[model samples]
Structures are given as structure tokens and as C-alpha cells.
Target: MTYALTNMRRVLRELRQERPADVPARLWRYAKPKLDVLGEEVLYRARLMGPLAARYRGPGIALMFHEIQSNVDDELRTGCSAGHLRQVIHAVRAAGRDIVTPDEALRRLGDRQSAPFALLTFDDAYADNRLNALPVLQELDVPMTLFVPTGMITREIDAWWLVLRAALRSRSEIALPPMERTFQCPDLASKTAALRQITAWVGTDQARAESLSETLGPLVSDPASLVARYAMDAKDLTQFAQHPLVTIGAHTKTHRFLSQLSDGEVLAEFTSNKNYLEALLGQPVEVLAYPYGTPGACGEREARLAREAGFKAAFTTRPGHLFPDHLKTPHLLPRIDIGYTPQRRSALFSRLSGFQRAMTTRWGAPVAVLD
Candidate 1:
């Protein structure tokens, strides 16, 4: 019992530092199915109470996905297996919701329609989106929006978070001169903690973080191969943009958190990426998905700049369903991140059904606030 208690504490410490973004969700992952079942029961009971219950239902929902691949060993945790992707589509449709493009959902919400709808969005321009997700989406005949970080395509930069993680995983010790710190990463737990600290520093001081990373030299033996393996290059982006059912959107120039940048930096990030995407795709790019997409990563200032830069809308990683009130503030749109676990099907449905949103509001205010 003493040994078990010690192990538990060690696990908690590692999780607290490494996965701060989704600590509660990660802790509840295993028990999610039971909670989802309870949520569904509550919803069913509410529906039995008559038309008043229907009023709480959201008109539309936008689902966010990162990578769609079966490879379990990938460093990025934001991927759902291809099989789960298919199941998610089937489950959403089975629940009697119409899957629509982000544009259509926006238009319909403006028209004040109460019909349930869903929108699919892919972020970071991962190659798996084309290689794995596209076939599933095409087979289901669903439309999706893909947000690209133009710098990734041009090879001007790679995702610093990925690079940091790779380095911590490979090396036993790393030095962070900016913070005057050194980390011992002899195991996955220590490496994760090291990654968390480094990532926070990167988020705060990207330039210094970049210099430090470069000073440390290549994390992986083959830097070029790593970039190609993770991100879509210019040629890949060109072909992906031509997909009839895919809508291309800008995700900034370097995939940096807008909230960390100055107004001028934010504007340049939006305009530069939008211009490059529009020129490459030969279509108007009017939507933006903030990198990181969380409240801390993007806020009112970033959203305003996005609109001023000629974008029609912007998305955040906030978990919620879309309401008519959201149309008033299109730039601050909320989205639900799909799970990567095998049993995420139920959790996906729970989110799509608005049960989670409803429960979330029961404790506090609604997830989607009116403008």
C-alpha cells in the first residue's frame, strides 16, 4: 500500500507538470465513458420534460481535429486513429445532425435556424489530414476546413513544441541558457516535465527559446526528414488546397500564440499567411484559427486583428456548441477537440449532443458567451 501511494504521487506530479492544458480531462479519461453515459441519461430525462428542454440545445457545433493517423508512437498527442474518425462521423450523423461546412453553419446560424448541424476543422496542416483523414471525410461526403501555418510549408520554421519534445525524448540532459536551467531527462516522466518547462519558456520568449534550441543543435539526427515526416510541404499544401470539399484557412505565419505577440506581430502573422495561402490556392482565404487556440493563447486583441486583416471568422479551442449569439462574435468562435483515445466515440457524441455544454453551464455560465 505504501509503495502504491508513492507511485500515485509520482504519477500525479508528472501529469500536473507535463499535461497542464488538459489535466482534469486526462485524469478522467478512463472514467469518461461512465460520465458520458450519465450525461446521456440526464439529457434523455430532460427531453422527456418537453419543449422547454429543447431550448437549451445548440443550433450548431464545430469539431476540431489535429492529426488523423493510426501511428500510436507519434510525439504529438492530438491525433485520433483513422478508425475512430470514421466512427465519429457515423455517430454524429446517427444522432440526426447534419454535417455542414463552417461557412454554411455560419450562414444558417445568421438565418436563425434551430436545426442541429456540425462543422469539421483540421489544424496545423498535418500530412495525415490528406493521407488519412481526407479519404474518410470524402467517403462520408463531409466538408471540412483546413487551417495552415504558411511558415511550415515554406520551411521557414518548424513547430518548436515538437522540436522541444523530440529533443527531450532523445537526450538525457538539456541546457536552457535563457532560463539558466538544465533538465535531466533520463525517463519519459522526467522528459515530459522538462518539455513542459521548456514549452512554457518558449511560449513566453520564443526568440530566446529558438536561439537556445539552435545552440543545442539538432535534436534528431535528420532535421529535414523530421519536418517532412510531420508537416505538409508547399507541394502537399498545393494539392490539398485543390480538394473540392476542403476550405483552406490561415493559421498564422509561424504558428505562434497570438496573445504572446505584439499587435504589429499579430497583424503580420495574419496578413502574411492569408496572402500566401490565397496566392497559392487561387481562392479567397477569409477564416483564421489561432495557433494554440486557447483563451490564454488568443484573446480579443488577436480576434480584432484577424477581422481587420479581412478574415470573416476566427476559431478558438474553447469547448462548446455554437449558438445564434456566436454569430454576433464570429471571430471568437468555440470548438470541441476530439479525443485521441480508442473509446472516445462516446465522449465525441456527448460533446456533439450538447450534454457536456449544458452540464458545464449548470455549474457556471454558458460556454459560448454572447458578444
Candidate 2:
């Protein structure tokens, strides 16, 4: 309790004393992520996300990555090539940062043994992580956590975002149902816009995700092969789990956006997935990464449920450096997402080093982590 109070006071002191510009508190949730991909400057200068602004240097950052595969769209935005994976490991190391697994990250932070460490996490357990990424990570000799969505392995779900990207790229025109609006995909910009629009219509609610998959599947050339080409099957998990550098974790069964589901549904998702992964991996599964982890998708309720579901820790998509206050709320850990296609290595370094997030965050405050 004393330490928690002290941390709160410290955060307030920096917010007022430093008076680092507030881009209308909470806008960072919407703005900080888009600059790297969309490159839009709204509510604050997007370029100001770099070089050094001096704040929010938390214990360590749990850096999130998705597929380490070559792609043209990468709408998931965290997918990168094998070369990109190599570059990230070398770059983080060069910055004098330690790359650790999720368990180590939690231990160090829980004990308040704060240091400039980076926890490399790959979500959705893509097949390319074995085919492409394993070589790169093995060569670099870095430890990382892979969060697997069990449904993907069982062929029960598609990573809808990638499917959307594929659909947009395949045809120049798309006809959206219910609303009956058609999107033109003659270029990248148009395709991206269409992707978001379709997502907004279906991504928020779990009920609509099925509709999205069924609707868009026909658009792709080989819809049935999407999961096969992308997700890691049971065989992959069985072999990969034995690697010294790899730690397997749960990413729910179907990657349903939790906020859209009822409490009972959420609990079921967490427990079932954990049990399934434990059985398959022949090891204890202790960590979790929420699907579509964001303020809109999850909050304290989901965090508490994660704890209830017997997870040692859980992670969110919130972008910030991990701080001591985070110890009070292990289930809601924050992570900085590595760029899908980083334009400048230096600017990315700025983001990875925790400078970019510190600068643009409103009043130098982290996204309201623990109450």
C-alpha cells in the first residue's frame, strides 16, 4: 500500500512538475499507434514520438510481435519478415537492453528489480515462427514468449485481420454486406481504409467475427489454406514447446475480443484455453495475452478474470514501458508493439527505447494501469 501510494504521487508529480504537453489525456491510445503505419498527425505532432522526450522509462517493455513472415499487406501491423526479426534482436541488444522471456519479466518487475529489459513476445503462434523466425531468433540466441490461440491450431478460426488484408489485395472492389457499401482497393491507402472500415463493422463484437470470416473467406483465392499457411498446428506446438528459448502461453481459444463477451464467456475462454494449452504442451501454461488487447477490448474485469483463471500474469496491447505500479496489476501488463514495416530504424529505436511513448503520452501518465 505504501509503495503504491508513493508511485501514484510520483506519477502526479511528474505530470504537474514536468508539465510535458498533454495531447488531451487518453488520446495516446488512439494516436501513438497510428503514426508508424497511418502516419497521421492529430491531437499532437506525430513526428514528436521520437529521438528523446525523457519520461515513462518503466521497469522494462514487453515488446509484442506477431508473424515473422514476409507479406505485402501485414494489416495485423506487427507481422515482419525474418530479416526484420534479426534486425530487432540486434538493435535491442545494441541499445544496451536485455531481452528476456515473459516469466523473467514478471519476476523482475514483481520484485521491483527494475532495469532496462525487453521481453520479446510473439502472438497468435504463427507457423512462420518455426519456418522463418526460429532461424533468426536461434541465430540471435534470444528468448521469447509465443502466445497461441488454440482455435487457430484446431482449424476453428481464421486470424480475420490477415484474411481481410488478403481479400483487399485480391480484388480491386469489395462489396460490404448489411451496409451494402463497396470499397475500392486500387491502392494501398484505399485497401487499408477498407480494412479498418470492415473491421469496425465486425471486429468489436465476437458475434460478428464469425460473420466476418464467413463473408470474407470467399474473396480469398484459397480461403481454406489461410489458417494452414499462417497458424501453428498442434504438431508445431508440440515440437516448439521443447525449445530452450521458447515459452508457450495462451491467447484464448478463438481470439475473440473479450470486452464484447459476457463475464461467464470470458472466464470460460480463459480457463478452457489454459487447460488445452497445458495438455498439449506437456508443461504449465502460466501467462496470457488478450485478443485485441486495448481499453475498448478489455479492462479490470478481464484482468481479474485472468487471475481467476489461474494465470500467473497476463498482457494487454497497451503501448507503454512497464513500471513498478504494474506489479500491483500483473494481469494488465503493457507492451510496445514493434512496427509491421518500420520506416526508419532509428525512429523505431526511439520508440523501443521508451522515448517516443513517454513524449506523446498525456501528462506523462501511463494508460490508467491499476485503478
Q: Which 10-residue span in candidate 2 carries the lowest summed lDDT?
A: 36-45
Superposed model 2: Cα runs more than 4 Å off: 1-52, 73-78, 111-115, 200-203, 367-371
Tell me the deviation in Å of residue 14 in model 2. Answer: 43
Query: Which candidate should be chosen as best, given TM-score against the real structure?
Result: 2
Error of 2 at 120 (Å): 0.5
In model 2, how large is the Cα lDDT of residue 15? 46
lDDT scores in order: 0.75, 0.75
Error of 2 at 109 (Å): 1.5
Q: lDDT, candidate 2, residue 162?
A: 67
lDDT of 2 by residue, 87-142 (tens): 88887887667888887787777766455688888898888888888887788889
Model 1 lDDT per residue over 13-92, tens place: 65666657788775785357457576666655656422323444577888888878766334533367878888888878
Error of 1 at 203 (Å): 5.9
Report the C-alpha displacement of residue 277, candidate 1, in angstroms: 0.6
Residue 125: error of model 1 in Å?
0.7
